[model samples]
Target chain A: MIERFQYDNRIVKNFLFVTIMWGVVGMLVGLTAAIQLVVPSWNFADWGSFGRLRPLHTNAVIFAFVGNAIFAGAYYSLQRLLKARMYSDMLGKIHFWGWQLIIVSAVITLPLGMTTGKEYAELEWPIDIAITLIWVVFGINMMGTIIKRRERHLYVAIWFYIATWVTVAMLHIVNSIELPISMTKSYSWYAGVQDALVQWWYGHNAVAFFLTTPFLGLMYYFLPKAANRPVYSYKLSIIHFWSLIFLYIWAGPHHLLYSALPEWAQSLGTVFSIMLIAPSWGGMLNGLLTLRGAWDRVREDPVLKFFVVAVTCYGMATLEGPLLSLKSINAIAHFTDWIIAHVHIGGIGWNGFMIFGMVYWLVPRMYGTKLHSVKLANAHFWLGTLGIILYAVPLYFAGFFQSLMWKQFTPDGFLMYPNFLGHTAGDQDGLRTARYRR
Target chain B: MDTLLEIKTAYVLRVIGGSVYLTGAFLMVYNVRKTVISGKLIANEDAEAPPLEKMDQAKESGHWHRWIERRPIQMLVISLIVVGIGGVLEIVPTFLVKTNIPTISSVKPYTPLELHGRDIYVREGCYTCHSQMVRPFRSETERYGEYAKAGEFVYDHPFQWGSKRTGPDLLRVGGKYPDSWHYYHMYDPTSMSPGSLMPPYMHMFEDLLDTTTTKRKIEAMRTMGVPYAADFPAHANDHLSAQQDKIVASLKKDGIEAQKEMEIIAVIAYLQRVGTDIKAKEVVEAKPANP
Candidate 1:
């Protein structure tokens, strides 16, 4: 018997709008923080200084910008893949507004100097609880839709979505175990080395499950649809999905390399991070190869162009991630501008472009019209491409220069560049050149 | 400080780059807006699909993987287990096992004043720019003193071994400067380190230390295995005020007037205490270095 239903495009639209809005806001904050590094006066008092605003910028970009994009792309794709409306419209509305509220709370509290002091997981106890609650709402809504899916076989994309949902939930609950001293203040349950391990475990997986996985899910869906092709290889998708999640969890310790984390755990992180290249590239290749015979279309269609660049960036960033995890490279690269450059490649080139591509593809179909202008989109593609190069390239050079200068010594066994500011000053020219080009 | 002038060109470029990115974002917004205006939203689109049929367990003789994929609950559980293995193996041993983080007997808990000051550090998000962990490299040791030990941070509730080093490592910053220097530096960074990018934390001088939470904080620390005496929370404030008074008197000796209750005094206490543990000869005889 045939079943007739409507796919909810309203929730997708709302999420997409939030994604674009937050993208602008988050990037603006990032640019401000960047400038604050060069001009200290821009840091206005305790409320608007680099110290507080940096977390605001990071949280906004990762959780607000990319996070909403994930939901927007996932909701649209998940519904179609499942062949069902969302299980509950109320739940969808609640999830959407609840997430926005959490972002708002972060904006208000983080700048006010209310924080738990964890790097990525910096939200105080109340906000953490709010995130957990909203996350559970999202999880229930997703699992409900999956259980009620009209399609018999779960798509590869759905599998990514499931892993993202479950893994993020687990990571959040485990890392957010803080004993609260007040409503807004709390101490981490894990102390010292144990705390470091736990925080990074959550931090690394936040990248893996939150940033990488869901975007991959979107790519798997949107890339194929835009190119009008099936995935390049079904078996490869299976291999890619499973191995990526399994390997990514152990790679957290690489963040603590050369720090006081246990040697065995550090080795585990390094070994697994190196091992992650296979599945990561597998997914990248699969996305790019989906457009194999459609090279002309890719050149003509701006959406496919965005996707092509995004997937290529994914490959480059993934390769770099593993290389940086190596002990020798990590010695120079860790805590330098190189790490910053590495993330932006994934952030702007991979995740940002993917969001652009997905949005361009979705808006037209959902609104029952052709795109506003292919030329403008192509222009965005170039400008954004230029922006990323301008942003990442100089920082990469700056990283090398900074690390070398920090390690340099005079022949008489004295520090060559004794002042830390000298190294920072060395990179300013390169950074200026890069940002100026953007 | 001469290099500070060179940073101006980079600042201009950052502005330009940011504007260019912003311009692209504006283009996207316009493009999306035009698309939205030209077309109507389909709040819901009609779709048709065959109803999912309940599969028979006996008849399901295909690949083993297909069985799990069809069941979302089972798949979620399995994924949790697979990911859990890594975190559990890495974290549980460090917590439960003794040798993972060997104790340094000289390492002791922060005094009530220093603990409050540490809270101020956390509050300001100083860890964003400065790292507390110094890797055991020749250059790092030469520049930042001794390499960091895991045992040194046992009392740190949320370890601030930060990832990035936008500023120099602060692990061994203790005893490196006078209290007046820290006071002036926190009041205005450029006064001490010329061309420093660090923001002036003038509010620390104006704000009084909120010792209201001292008891609760001490209790929380004790709960988290900090090894504070069971009776410590009851007298924590007395210890805090005593330390605060000493810091205030020392700052006065340096020709700087400061109140005993000022947040800067507490911050001074914390900074003077940081990374000074290993230098002590005996645990019972540990004393904070004078500025």
Candidate 2:
């Protein structure tokens, strides 16, 4: 006998609501940080200084905004893909509330300057323990559902999902191994070059697994569904998944190029990072070409427009990603605003757009009503596209200008622009004013 | 036709390699089962899908990978092995190979006062803007005196060689300015380096260094392979006071004292300690003429 069960979409709805709330909060923190960069006086007391708030902004965005979006999408899609409700409603609630509590803890701790000083892995020991526990709960819930899945074929999308969970767990555990000195402070297990290597291995891949893989899963599911078509090529996707996972892991050293890290490891990172373009494009092509017959609908449908831009941004970033990893390019671009511009290209364009598209496609269906304003959604799309362009373009110009001035040595090997170019072209106040109401 | 044959040969080799890896993994799993499964099986109250007995018949007709997919346990284990292999390969070698980090004979451990100041630097997140790693590039070397060597950071507990460079590198900033420059800069950064984007570190002047933790921090450093001289921790307070008094005298010459026992003193001590090891000989020769 076949038993039917309603998908526990209430959990999905709760996560989706939290997504909007956290997105607003995270973006506001980020906006404030950008403002502080331009107007140093805006830095409030010690707790509200730019240095403290910068980590808060990053944590809030990565673990809060993007984190909640992943949960909402995963909960909704996992149930439907397996043709079963989540394995346990109790576990689902635990995962949801537990994650929120962790984000709340971060908000309180990071602003107080209680950090391990590692980027992305900045949360102190107690919070790190909480993260590991919550991650296990999430893993058990996911694995439980997959085991009891009524479907026969595990889709390529699920491959990405599985990789996301496993890689993130490994990254988090390895990076969070710190010796605590106080309630809110700790030291990394590794020091000097070793710490840099390990942190970037965790740091670079945090972007790969946390930001990239899960969203690729979302793209696989939502892009095809919205376009009313099947995927472009299943064989290509299979190739894309395996090659990406294997290649991405070796590319972390690219972030440490021309630094104190050993030359061999740096070279390894560059080679693998460059090779990543092949699989990245394969995934991008799969999404874009899936809308083969449905391309006409893109003009009217705001959701499809978001997916198109998202896929295109994915293509641009993946292409630029490899180019940036080249030793020649890295020598100049490593610490400059160019890297910031490249990251925002991926962050605002790819991840932000995908989330917006998913939210728009999902919200009405969950609420059992059509969208109240398609015109407003269209407005958001243009405004967002324009906003990203305005934010990224000026920084690219400034990054190159600053880099050139820094590198412009006289024939006698004295710094050419040391006294003349007194002020750095590093003013990024342009970023503060015009972000998408993200 | 020749290229096609080569491709087929590569594919066959891959099949052989993959099978060997998987078989070894399966043997380990079986070995664990022999030890644990015979002891006890935990009662799992989990819902499970009905098995498809048609797998053998359908293997010739259906997607080959689906057989493993239907068994989530096998799939999860396989995924774990694949992802786990890379981390093991990269990290194990780094830890085992002592030659990866070449030591410098001249490099010495931080003093008690300097150690506390380094910790204060960490607390301030100063690493966010001012990087400590001076690369071998001509631009970097010209701007910041000398290139950094790996062994120079042997005693930096968690290594604050920050990735970005919003400000100038600080690895070689020692002895570059008078004591008064740092004091005025901490009070108001714009006063010293006009148009600099750095914020004033005013609170550091008010907050006294926590002398209680100095002994514990020194002991911790010794445990981390930092070679502190014997009796260093016992006289840590005395050493800190002597260092503070010297800094106060130096600042008096410049007509300012941020505070004799303040956190600012500790940070100044740490900053002055940087890049001084290579210059120790020159300093000793010129010490009589410096003041």
iRMSD in angstroms, per model: 4.0, 18.9
Candidate 1 vs. true structure, TM-score: 0.95
Write one digit per residue (lDDT tens) for candidate 1, span B1-291: 323344444445655666676678889999999999999999989999988877663337766667776788888888888888888888888888888888898899999999999999999999998999999999999888889888999999888888888778999989877787788889987666666788999899899999999999999999887888999999999999989888888888878989898899999999998998987744345455532
TM-score of chain A of 1: 0.96
Worst 10 residues of 1 chain A by lDDT: A428-437
TM-score of chain A considered alone, across all candidate predictions = 0.96, 0.95
Q: How high is the TM-score of chain B in model 1?
A: 0.90
RMSD of each: 4.9, 13.6
DockQ of 1: 0.53
Cα deviation at A242, candidate 1, in Å, is 1.0
Regions of model 1 farther than 4 Å from truth: A423-438, B1-15, B57-64, B282-291
Per-prediction TM-score to the true structure, in the order listed:
0.95, 0.88
Which candidate wins on TM-score? 1
